[model samples]
Target chain A: MIPLSWYLILAAGLFCIGLFVVLTKKSAIGILIGIELMLNAVNINLAAFWHYYTQLNPSQTPLNGMVFLAIVFIVAAAETAVGLALIISAYRRRNTSVAGEMDLLKG
Target chain B: MTAMQIIFLIVAAVTLGGALMIATSRRMMHTVLWLVLTLMGVAVLFALLQANFFSVVQVLVYIGAIAILILFGVMLTRRSMVDAGESLVHKNWWVVAVVIALLFAAIVISIQPWGAAHTPLVELMEFKEPISDLGEALVDPAAYLIPFEVSSVLLLAVMVAAIYIAVDRKGGKS
Candidate 1:
């Protein structure tokens, strides 16, 4: 049986890597990729905690964590859809997809 | 170490490595490929956690839907699939690295003190019809009904908005 901390540590590492990508990637799509990674890391944490919680409280319904994770998944899908749409719209206008190059309002 | 522990370690390493590659890979197409690998690894982790439904959903929604969407975005936005002759990272990425290191250390330290952190997972409980339970909870008036309906509405709105935003106007510049 794996310790809960191991999962937590893995989630932390994954989250940090995702953060790094989000902070540094020059492409807007790359940032979206990073956000997906971060969201997956969160899903892992939620699943891990839920697993442990079920162990301690067997009588309670074990749907909460899974429910929350479902919501996160829904949100991730919407985010990707809207984000890519905006990116495509912006790309059509700017003729470039680089995040740093899309500064029209730079004063 | 137990087999489960070993498996977890390998999956974690692969997942994190894929994430690192996504961050550092110079080509956008390669980055999207790495994202698929990383997302698959996460789905594996979900299976390891005994959430079979989520494991399937992770693959279906993440790899199948979101990853393909990202790939399309990459292909559509760039003139060529290969992204070259441009800096992939910010000039001051090292600063961000340092900050992330501190953040990771803080997370580790904070997690270490929890009494339940070291508890090993017990044997799996006999969950009869987990999928049905999840379905019932989603539609039940008392549980997750509102949130589920709200999310459905949100998805619908997002779909409409995305179509509006991405469609080309007849008079607008292409």
Candidate 2:
């Protein structure tokens, strides 16, 4: 059997990579990509924890972990939609996608 | 060394490597492609964990739907951002690297209890069909009915907001 820690470690690594991407990338879409990666990491963690804990109390319904992940998936999707819409609107107003150049509301 | 470990390693490599490429790729389209690959690996990982339903959801919602939306966002959004700078901004790479490294260490250290390698894996004894139960639970007033309804409302609100923001007006370009 594969150890649950492996999944956790992988998720953590992926999360760090997402953080790096979000911090270093200049484009709004790239930041969105990083957010997606981070969300994936969270799902991995939730699934791993669920799988690990349900072993102890197999009688209880294992719906909670999956439900949490499912809800997160839905929220992440909605967040992406709104984020992309905002990014596109900003692009329309500014004519550029560079993160540094978006200084209209900075003041 | 086992089949499961090998599969996990492969998925991890694909996911992490694709994420790295997405971070460093200069072109937006390439980043999207890498994102797709990473998402696919995550789906496979979900399947390996025996959450086949969520694996399907990951493919359908993430790869099929969300990816296309991201592509549309990229295509529709900057028509000509030529000097948009490098995807991996060199000026802040060192700081970001340090931060990510510290964050990764913290997470790994914190997740030790639930996922230590010594913990043995046991088969799920009950609940033949978790997917059906999930569906039932969504509507079951004693379970997650409130969250289910709330999420639907949230999705509706988000859809309306997205449409509102993405639409163009007669003289709103400025």
TM-scores computed on chain B for all candidates = 0.93, 0.87
Query: Taking the tens digit of each residue's C-alpha lDDT, what string does model 1 give over B1-174?
Result: 988889988998899999989888988899999999999999999999888899999999999999999999998987722444767788899999999999999999999989889999866768653788899888999888999999999999999999998887755756
Candidate 2 CAPRI category: medium
- Model 1, A25-95: lDDT tens per residue? 88888889999989989999999998998889888878988898899999999999999998898888777
Model 1 scores a C-alpha lDDT of 0.89
Candidate 1 wrong stretches, greater than 4 Å = A105-107, B80-84, B171-174
Interface RMSD for each candidate model?
A: 1.3, 1.8
Which consecutive 10 residues in model 1 chain B have the weakest lDDT in total? B78-87
Q: Cα RMSDs of all predictions?
A: 2.0, 2.3
Mind giving the per-residue lDDT tens digits that candidate 2 earns over B1-174? 777778788889999999989878878888899999999999998888778889999999999989999998888864555554444355778888998898888877777765355575544655474788899999999999999999999999999999998777646644
Best candidate, DockQ-wise? Answer: 1
Instruction: Estimate the TM-score of every prediction.
Output: 0.95, 0.92
Question: Which pairs clash inside model 1?
Answer: none
The complex in candidate 1 yields a DockQ of: 0.79
State in Å the error of residue A104, model 1: 2.4
Q: What is the lDDT of residue B97 in candidate 2?
A: 94
